[model samples]
Target: MRLSTVILPFRRWHDGGADQWRRAEELGFHTAYTYDHLSWRSFRDGPWFGAIPTLTAAAGITRKLRLGTLVTSPNFRHPVTLAKELITLDDVSGGRVTLGIGAGGTGFDATALRRPEEEAWTPRERADRFGEFVPLLDRLLSQDTVTYEGTFYSAGGAQNVPGCVQRPRIPFAVAATGPRGLRLAARHGQAWVTTGDPKLFETGTPQQSWEAIRAQTEKLAKACADVGREGDGPERILLTGFTPDRPLESFEAFVDFAGRHAELGFDELVLHAPIPDSPFAADQRVFERIATEGVAALGG
Candidate 1:
């Protein structure tokens, strides 16, 4: 399974930024992901460096680690503008870019964008808009001139200056959890990443969370079959969670979990460390240990 690391810039963990990203490359991490949050939920609002700029900086620093936003909200920026930024970043990264996007969830405030709360659309609407927006963006980014019109957006003879650096097409992935969202991911995304409570595994034998993930995968695979897509369908299915504060007594549990996910046809497992207040002292020993032993157990 491919392992990736996520950086929470808002927490200010790494001081050297690009320099630290280089260090992560040396540690065998394949992809480096980042988060985008306009406001600090309820606490504060400040001049935060936007997702595109931060990704550009990381791309400039690292040689191999693929870069992507963990997930960007459609509410913040129009799909056309986002496609342009992603293509530019892909050029900067030497085709090492993956677009991870999703419908806006709770925590995002559109008021800053001058849109009222009621103006906020439901998750289903956002997903539908995203479904429409992505294909149009893909066409625009892939070709010179494009003309299209949709319910939410329209363009007439729109031509992007230069196409994306990625030869075929940039890899696209969606962060989804619900049924509609999962179906959307199967339809459009090259991968799926999910994180939340463990209740999803509580079945008869206390394996509800794992069962839920399996169920989602089955549903997604059916969607892929309906569309007649080829090759193991989506190449990756990333599961994110915090490691226990205490060391796991039996690594067997994790081994079994990985095997179960593999049986369900997941290609990767990503574990995000809890964000620490300080930069250099985040205590990565646990992560390092998992990389060393647990990865071996899972045959990564």
Candidate 2:
């Protein structure tokens, strides 16, 4: 299992922000991702930087580490604008960028820009929008000029000159568990992402979480089969921290945790970088040790 990490966008660049990304590369992480939010939960009141800018800066400092958002959604983004930014970011990173995208949840992002009279999108509406969003974003990134119209979004002769540094655009790591979302991932993703089932987070056992993910992979395989890509689906990525398993408690724990997920067919495992005084908080030393030694232990 390849090891990766998510570094929450809670720090300012001048105040040791760049150092964390630089250190991520030094520690040999495959990719260092961040939350793509205007402001995330709990950290809403705290400093949260823009994902594109943070990634551009990280690209400037790191030579080999891949950079990406854990998942950017259509919550507050238009496909045209987001595609332009991603193309620039891909060039900045020298093609070392991945776009982990999802159909956003009903968080502050859902209503952050809405007027008082405007209601947030319902689950059905969110799903409908995502179905349109991903395909259009795909076209906008891969094609030179796109002119299309849809219920939730549109493009009017939008132009992306010279396109992405990564041919056919940067790799998309689509985050999904639902059938329609999985279908999208199977059709368009270079990687499929999951955090297990959030419903099981509170009361479910770790064994149950593993089973849930196993079921998800099965669904993904079925989705790929439907699209005539059976046995050659996107790479599977499990973003840890939402589930009950505490993989980073120690090097041994991470190895065991990663090994089990590997058995479930996950190609990569992502742990959150240690955060102080938060739910994601963990011992920094342990996190570093895992980054340095955990992958070798897992024979990554």
Candidate 3:
């Protein structure tokens, strides 16, 4: 399976996120990413940079490593505008861009965007909005001129004259676990990303969590079949942010984790950011060790 790492855009990133991305690429990571939020819940009071500029800079600095937002949503930006931005990013990144999208939750981002209390989105409404958002982006990125008026958005003859560097569009890594969200991924995503059983990750053992995701991955295969997808549904991406507070049991867990994901048909694995400053001095030792030994063990 391919490997990616999400670099949190705090602490020593103000100068350049690219430096970290360069290191990730140098170490043989396939993709590099930043979290997409106006302001994330943890470190809300601390500094946080927008995902686009960070990714754009990452594109400028690196040639081999793919770049993307770990998850962007339609909370503050409309699909029409965001579509153009995404294409431009593809152009800047020379087509090595993947759109990792999700149904945005009610958190600091919603409040910072000034979403009205009366208009607060429930889980269903968030999913509904996301459902409209992805397909609209797909059309806007590929079609020369398009007019769309959905329940949540409208684009009046929007133009994408030259189109994207990637033919129809850049790859979309859609994040989902629910039926509706998974269906959307089956319809539009080149890659389907999941963190497994969302609540279970907080308390379950590593193996347990992996087992849960394996079941969900099987469910996704069924969803693909329902949509008449024959060969392969989409590239499966397992995001390793299930429990951010805890570190993996290092080499053994890392090797087994990547192996299981590959065996279960996952195409890529996205690692959560490790603590920049850890008592064991993890940032340097763990990642490099993973790159040299762990990934080798998994045949990455």
Candidate 4:
């Protein structure tokens, strides 16, 4: 299984941001991702680091680690502009970039964007709009002229000049939590990244949370099959957040749980360390353990 690391963009740890990325490469992480939020839900930090610039910085620092947004909100930027920026990053990274995106989720600074709370659509509506946006993005990234007409957005014969440096197309992933979103990921994304406290689901005690994730993965697989797309086949199921207090048993259960999903064809499993204010804090020890024993046990 391939493993990656997720980092928050807004913090002092990110101040030496490019150097931090180089450290992740040295730590043997295959990819490094950053969140694209103006402000986090529960904490305030230094000035928000815009996603594109930080990713570009990551590109300059790491030669092999794939760089990307953990999940950028579509509501925050126009699809055409995002496509261009992604292509530019891909070129700078020598085609080592993946675009992970989603409709805006909670803690989103809608007011900061000057979008009223009521104007924010329901998850269903956001999913519908995202459906329209993805195909347009795919076209634009592929250097095709976009002539799309949709309720949320419309464009007329706008050509995306200087296509992505990545051959064929840059890989696109989706961070999904709901059924509609999962279906969208199965159809549109090359991979899906799931975020949650895995301990809530991994303990053998039959919890609703664990059942929900299993059901969601089953539904996602079916959705892919319905659309004639491969679902969680290989390098598709990128599960994040599987940390526990103890290293051995916790890591064992974590690998066991992921292996169950792998039996169902779920592929990549990325364990995210808890976000910390400082990069070398106590929480980082968990990542160190995973980099050593946890990865070896899971065959990462």
Candidate 5:
């Protein structure tokens, strides 16, 4: 099983991204990821950085820690431009990039471009849009040149110059909460991630969240089977923190949460690095403890 963490980019303004990710790699994290939002609601009032650029800079600093977005959606950018950026990131990282994506939320990300309210997307429309978007991205990355004309997006002679360092492109870590989204993950994901019931997190009950993950995994397994993929088709990634309601509050809680996810059939787990609010050394101490005593407690 693999273990990873999400570095909240807004929090890294003080320490800088390079130090944050390198610490994760040096501490034995398999992957390091950042939340991909144009403006996360919590930090909407203040400074925030772009997810792709933060990850690109992280790629330059770290050697082994696989880097990616927690979940990038087709809310603002076209698939063509995203494909080019992702492939270049793959090359720059020596193929250590994983593209985690999903059907976008209807928050600032959707309205950031100021599209018409009548054109505001329903859940079903978002699903349909996602279904179209992922396959096109798949084609854009794998093929040398792509010419696609779909209901949601179109591309003409879109060149994937030099292609990806990872043949057939970087692995996709697709996140899904609904059936339509689950099937998309089954169809194209190299790794699968879920945070369980978003509603359940409002109450911060770890047990309930774990149950949601278990149920989702069963459905995901069937999604794979329907498509003739094996039971363990994609690496299952579970996100535990990155939210105020549900966090790794204590060392014991962190170890317990991670182990149970492994028991529930998830192959990988992700936690949120503490927001840098306290003294710098104190904030880092939290990470150091998680990497050392916390990881050691997970058993080798």
Candidate 6:
């Protein structure tokens, strides 16, 4: 299985930020992704940079490291504008950009744009909007000119002149677990991502978390079948850290962690790059060792 890392956008490009991207490339990570949010939880008051710009900058600095968002959502984005930015980013990266996208959560981002008096989107509404969002995005990225009118978004002959460097736009790594979202992923995703089950994050054991991921992957397979997709559908990705597993505690630990998930049909595994003082905190040394040696340990 391929190993990757999620580098949070909490540092400025010039202020020791570029180093992380450079180091990720040096460490031989398959891809380096960042959270695409205006402001994420906990890091809300801290120095959080924009995803596209950070990725654009990383693309310039790193030659082989693939760059992308852990997820960009429709919560505060429109397909037309997002597609435009992604097109430019793909060109800048020389087609090494994967747009990890999702239906978005009801966290700070859900209400960041709305007034206190205005209510946030209900669960059903969010799902309904996402249903419109992904396909519209798929079209906007693939076609040169699109004029789409949907319930949550409308594109008025939006022009994407030369289109993306990756042929049919950049690859999309869709993060989803629900039925509609899974169906959307099955249809549109080049890769499907999961952080296991959020419900299992704080309360469930590691074995339970693995089982939850197994079930979700089965659901994704069923979704792909529903869409008439033959063979293994989208690439499976399991983003580590959120689940109650200490994958990065040691190199051996990561090997064990990766071995189990790889058996669950995951094509790639993503670890959060060490953050100094947070839930994602880990020994930087161990992390680097895992990046360099852990994957090979799982093999002969």
Pairing residues by index, what is the TM-score of model 1? 0.83
Q: Residue 250's C-alpha lDDT in candidate 6? A: 86
Task: Give the clashing residue pairs of candidate 2, or none.
Answer: none
Q: Which of 4 and 5 is the better model by TM-score?
A: 5
Query: Roughly what TM-score does model 4 have, to 2 decimal places?
Result: 0.83
lDDT of 2 by residue, 1-300 (tens): 788999887888989899999999999999999989888888989899999999999999999999998899999999999999999999988999999999998878999999999999998888899999999999999999999988889899999999999989899999999999999999999999999999999889889999999999999999999988866699999999999888878778888889889998898889898888998889999999998898778776
Expressed as tens digits, the lDDT of each residue in 1-300 for candidate 1 is: 766776655533255555556766777777877776675442245334566888888888788888887777766767677777887898899999887777666555444665464666676777777777767766877777778889887768876767778865678777777766666677777787665334532322325555666676777777677777766777665645422212222355556666766776777666554345522234466565554577677766
lDDT comparison, 4 vs 6, better candidate: 6
Error of 1 at 14 (Å): 8.4
Record all residue pairs in model 5 with backbone atoms less than 3 Å apart, i.e. clashing.
none
For model 2, the local distance difference test gives 0.92
- Off-target runs (Cα >4 Å) in candidate 4 are 12-14, 115-118, 177-179, 196-208, 230-234, 242-264, 273-282
Q: For candidate 3, what is the total of clashing residue pairs? A: 0
State the lDDT of candidate 4 residue by residue for 42-138, as single tens digits: 4444456788888887888778898877777766767878887888899898999988888776555544665364666666777887877887787
Single out the weakest 10-residue window by summed lDDT for candidate 4: 240-249
Give the Cα lDDT of each candidate: 0.66, 0.92, 0.79, 0.67, 0.81, 0.92
lDDT of 3 by residue, 5-82 (tens): 888776555465557788888888888877888777667787788887778878888889998887998777688888
Instruction: Put down candidate 6 lDDT per residue, 89-155, tens digits, no spaces.
Output: 9999999999999988888889989999988898889889999999999999999999988877999
List the candidates' TM-scores in order: 0.83, 0.98, 0.92, 0.83, 0.91, 0.98
Candidates 3 and 5 compared: the better one by lDDT is: 5
Report per-prediction Cα RMSD to one decimal.
Answer: 3.9, 0.9, 2.4, 3.7, 2.8, 0.9
Question: Which residue segments of model 2 deviate by more than 4 Å?
Answer: none
| lDDT winner between candidates 1 and 3 | 3
